[model samples]
Target chain A: MIARLRQTVWSGITARVRGTWDSVADAIRPAVPGFGTVRRGHVALVGVGPGAIDLLTLRALRCIEAADVILYDRLVEPEVVALAPRKARRIYVGKEVGAHAWPQPRIDAKIVEEAQKGLRVVRLKSGDPSIFGRVTEELTAVRAAGLAVEVVPGVTAACAAAAHMQLSLTERGVSDTLILTTGTCREGDPLPESALHARPGTNTVFYMSVRQAARIRDGLIARGVPDGARLRIAADVAKPGEQLLHCALRDLPDTLASSSISGCAILMLTWPKEVEALSDPTVATETVAPVSAANAPS
Target chain B: MIARLRQTVWSGITARVRGTWDSVADAIRPAVPGFGTVRRGHVALVGVGPGAIDLLTLRALRCIEAADVILYDRLVEPEVVALAPRKARRIYVGKEVGAHAWPQPRIDAKIVEEAQKGLRVVRLKSGDPSIFGRVTEELTAVRAAGLAVEVVPGVTAACAAAAHMQLSLTERGVSDTLILTTGTCREGDPLPESALHARPGTNTVFYMSVRQAARIRDGLIARGVPDGARLRIAADVAKPGEQLLHCALRDLPDTLASSSISGCAILMLTWPKEVEALSDPTVATETVAPVSAANAPS
Candidate 1:
């Protein structure tokens, strides 16, 4: 049966080739309207998961190795950058705090120039390239250049931190709605109302907004969310400095300030599984004994 | 500077060791807590990414290798399953339509039994093990069995499918919300109203939902989502047999039915990027098309 299927497919392909050549002679084909279009260099936007060598996708690794030049950032871990061939030209396009090192236009220009040189160029970012990674601007730039572009996804840090902490972002009847946003807003931009008005069974994850932890906590209080809602502050996820703090949002500001943890941080809030123990009559009292707060049920 | 910091940390650690355990008698006392005081055979719930070897994280790999027995399912690709050590006993807990799959309670019992035997066991699932993969139920069961539990996350398919298609779920001002939901509804449960009521700037992703494509499309249209909203569908992502179909939601049902796309599928909806062509004003009429329901935009 398999042999018959293969033979049938081969016959179909041969018939098409023969028919095309017969219909358009070589002389006439030379004058065809859409001939001799050259293929352009392709751009692959790849993600390096949360500063860890082992966390990178195999497909992402292959893309980086095949690239002629790699545009990387400080957010990408050193080990991940090492995956690229030694001969591949590397460029730093990272934007640090108070510094827009490479402006938008210039970065777009660099990508187009490399592609025009017929070189496969890769734009590498930390975590999943799509989430809060300014990928849309890069995509628009590449498309405008008429170059083919693809994106390789990576492991985002929220999942990494939550997994390591043995917590489910969407536990049944706990957190069904999961929201991903940044805690820091533009100078004139208002804070996210979703974080402020957190529903009982929803999980909110904040990326790249550690400095605004206090403001986030205050907003939740103002919106009537329980002050004792669980908050997980994870820093340097999947890296050596990896730290996971389990606390309530109300006290997160003080707790984080007391600790010297800085650098890229992810903040997560959800109705925690620990709270479910409050329903077990025998264990409810003991579970809430540790630190009862304003929202604790009587 | 790094070396100096390391030395300072070491000195502080040494000072604590000397100050806390000053006498031979103190050293002779139990150096650690009793073994039985803490339960053993804990379950480590893990996610292996969509059928690609590179998609699995180093942490997940380590956890899988450490397990004495592995309980895995069909969502886990064959290539990934091969990563488990040869000596480890692997058990099939796959759930397929009308298949003799192990019930949730049975799987939970198996984990506990193996863990009680002092064997490291991994409960592995495809995509992020925690996301709609029943990790929470397993966690609760394991904890109730008095076993320690840990979670190691992998890349979720929703993000991966989007990346593979070179599409961004959120594009700043273009889209503010990205919602991911499983396609299945419980017996007697009604469809989600929020999911049906599509917001223009919000992107929605559905998993395990290819069979419901027709119903999903109808639900969206009935809920007042613009009929011109674009839909991108991909099946068997990151694997050989992968197929992609791009079209508008209004036409998605017909497209899927005619295309005969089944098996693992990812569905994406996005508000088109509205851009004015730079080179020619005429291009505005050609490419800068209005997002009217009259045209299929995907």
Candidate 2:
């Protein structure tokens, strides 16, 4: 009976000491610049940019290094995750096209539970988290739990792909507007109606549209996009084995059929010949193979 | 006469030695990773991102460090320019909205002239060099001069503003597409017709649009966009004095009039009420004050 009473007293003292330590740390955080001020159980949604470790912002790297728990997506580069402290717990919650290792609700619950214990949590995503990142659902759940949250933006895939090709999404008197859309939708969800048509003097970039190239081709053609319009397809941008393919709008399907590209591709429709002709002649001729030669039933 | 003859002969010897050194360096550059293989007098068009030093990619930093001369835009942060070597020549070619300090053609000629002198050049721009960056004109001139050129992408203002708000540009079943356009055009250049309308399930971000808020409001209203639609104006995004303003589409003109935002602002149109209601309640209530309360007749 005496030993049991002693053990209870020791446990009480330990809890008090930890509480004191946490309070002291909180007091010092405000004085340090770039130090995470995330409240006990707060979450930071950080964008790591498109695969290049150097693209990570200083604020993002600071937050990752300070996190106690990190949940990362599959598209995030391994080099980026290495920036986290060695003692921090790393969890992989990546969701593939047909496979979701940890469903959305479960991931949300895990973050909240960890935060409740007063641990700093970070959810790392590839590219800018605001673009097709399903950030709304996660933000809703975290805020509903009454936890503090902040977002750090990173470079998206479209920007990286454009950099690779030395191509601009907008040019004076050529293309004044840029549109970002996806050709594929969820199983029961239908594609947006506006995406079915292409507007003149506008550059359109379709994310995750490689699998539906034929459908995209037909939709654009039906909406009066000329068959001879120039298009660019970038696969595995900013990584080893990166490939860039240029073709006429009608030959996009054929180009993909001959190539082995299954993941992380972007399709961009650029300005017409009239505007392109005014630009560099070298760029005009880089990939200007005859349409008949590219599509001659090879 | 003897002194002049000695000077000419010394210059000839120096030129020959420099040529040999450049040939040797070029031969070894291809074998080194991250080392630029730019021939002497080549130009690299690099995007430095939206003013944050950490937002600079590894490739961009490397290029800057290796440059003999750097021509930077006004929007690029000073912290980023500090990354260049101390001996590198820094040139300010900033172009303000109403002030054309250095005309486009002059800037283009300067870069080519420097390259012709066999100096490695880096043309730095804020945000992605391709999007509304007038890259085609500069690129055409550089290529016509027979110089090597490459482009490096950076995070644009739209992505940075969305990140600052912790809001996603594309959400499932809400906004499936994102459009980026400008509100003001050059003299005699008409605004694109389709940009005036906000499509359902599409999020539109207008760059350099704060000064033209009244025109944007009238155009959208005429195109069937509801006056009650939610709008966000982000000023000086990702900068030290960054500010975000939330108001209805009808109040946008008044909001800008009341504030001191002239340039470096992004206007974003989110999803409609019906879709927003289906999402988080906190987001719904965060900026739902009555229009009259937000803008009293005082």
Candidate 3:
């Protein structure tokens, strides 16, 4: 299969296929026809999962297999990009690991520019694009230029991290709400404050926030989040070199500073609704009711 | 590929893979050795996406293809279940479909029973199992009995619905936080309160909440969520008969009552942080700045 992808991608026949394939999460909207007989190319803003090839959704894979050009981010695995047809063009729009890297604006221009040439383009992102993927800029740019685009959702890192720990992000009584927020904000925008977030009865995951660990800790503390709130920090989620850490909210900064995960890590805090203090001395260190025989009622 | 899955699954090669597979998000855990060499079966709690088969993650498809005994819910598409090996036992534990339907507690018991028999059990749920999938009960049950289990995450419903609409769920300047909560609670559990949730500067998606439309609307309104806040309601996301509605928070109940979508629907509302009011009379009907050229600053 890998060899086939290479052959197809490098096959030297680069003709765009227009919605010919079935079962790949067909574009929700029909393509708007271009005026004056000018052919228009299609772009698929596909998420390739947190890191692992296995986490890649079938729809995302299908989009790559049928692409005439693939513009991928650094988070996408090289093996995944290798799956495109041999006759396809591959471009790197990520911050690292590519000879032909481009920034966000350039990517917007390139996607619209390439589509105008009537090529099948795939803008591959890492994880689901809906969260912290800078999706607003790209979607606006594409739609502004009157081209057809579709988003193929992929498994986000939080889910992958939860799965890796063999735990769920939200539990029945422990947490009824799940928040998908980011540690960092857009340039020139105000940094996210914990006072505005960090709800009780919630499991909040902060993406791209490892660098702001201290700020996050202080902010949550300022917002009156319990000092002993449970946090699950993970990096390189499903990819090799995976690291998992369990600590209290107060220990987050020290724990991360001493650990190896950087930049790519996700910070998840579970602040259970005010619950009875644990009477069992064995597990007294934790706050919420742990998912054990001791608390089987939840 | 479909034929290959059938062969591998139905081939009666039921011996557990035991972390032998190279990829496929190979369980992040090592097997706990059973005492006295009593062979133990494994259970994989897999999320099969909202409804579409293509939205299924490769890791999930791998689990299903390798399943020895498959227990699937109603939200999972039939084609997804059909991919399991013909020899593999396929059981339905859903309330709406199949003759072998069983309730939640029975499922917890059944999963433990099958895994103890040394079968590779796949407990398939719709959407990401981490969110409102009742994972606490299931995971606790499996572990209490000293069995091994893993979770394979899939694209959750909110992401899928956002993708289907060709829009990003979390857009800059418009919505900073994304909350994934549900409308209904457990039989004895207290219902989720919008006052505790429904924050400004947040985009909240309610899963399995169509039945609670009036309650959700009333609660949000009472909590100061603007009556004209933009809402996007979608049902049967990514599957046939998919329906989408865009309305104000106040009209949610009435709009849902007049729509074709019933059950299996998600409701999303974006209550922006206090922003400057628009002067244009045409699109003034909306509270937040539109995503058009008029509001591209975000």
* Interface RMSD for each predicted structure: 23.6, 22.0, 17.1
Residues B84-184, candidate 1: write the lDDT tens digits: 66788999986776677888888988888888887788888888876667787788788888888888777887777878767776666554456665556
- Residue A267 of model 3: what lDDT? 89
Off by over 4 Å in 1: A1-42, A184-197, A211-215, A218-223, A252-257, A261-263, A271-298, B1-43, B62-68, B145-149, B185-200, B210-223, B252-259, B271-298
Q: Which ten residues in a row have the lowest lDDT in candidate 2 chain A?
A: A289-298
Q: After superposition, how far is residue A106 of candidate 3 from its true place, in Å?
A: 0.8
lDDT of 3 by residue, B6-50 (tens): 334322221121123322122212332331242358899998988
Alpha-carbon shift of residue A5 in model 2 (angstroms): 61
Model 2 quality (TM-score)? 0.78
lDDT of 3 by residue, A184-244 (tens): 7667878766334665567888888888888987776554455576778988887767899
User: Which regions of candidate 2 fall more than 4 Å away from where they truly are?
Assistant: A1-39, A271-298, B1-39, B98-100, B273-298
Task: Note the clash tally of each candidate.
Answer: 2, 1, 10
Instruction: Judge candidate 2 at residue B244 and give its lDDT.
Output: 94
What C-alpha lDDT do the candidate models reach, one value each?
0.65, 0.71, 0.72
Residues B132-203 of candidate 2 have per-residue lDDT tens digits of: 787877888899999988887887888888877878888777767888888766567776543443555678
List each candidate's DockQ score. 0.11, 0.18, 0.20
User: C-alpha displacement of B116 in model 1, angstroms?
Assistant: 3.2
What class would a CAPRI assessor give candidate 2's docking? Answer: incorrect
Model 1, A158-181: lDDT tens per residue? 777877777776654444445676
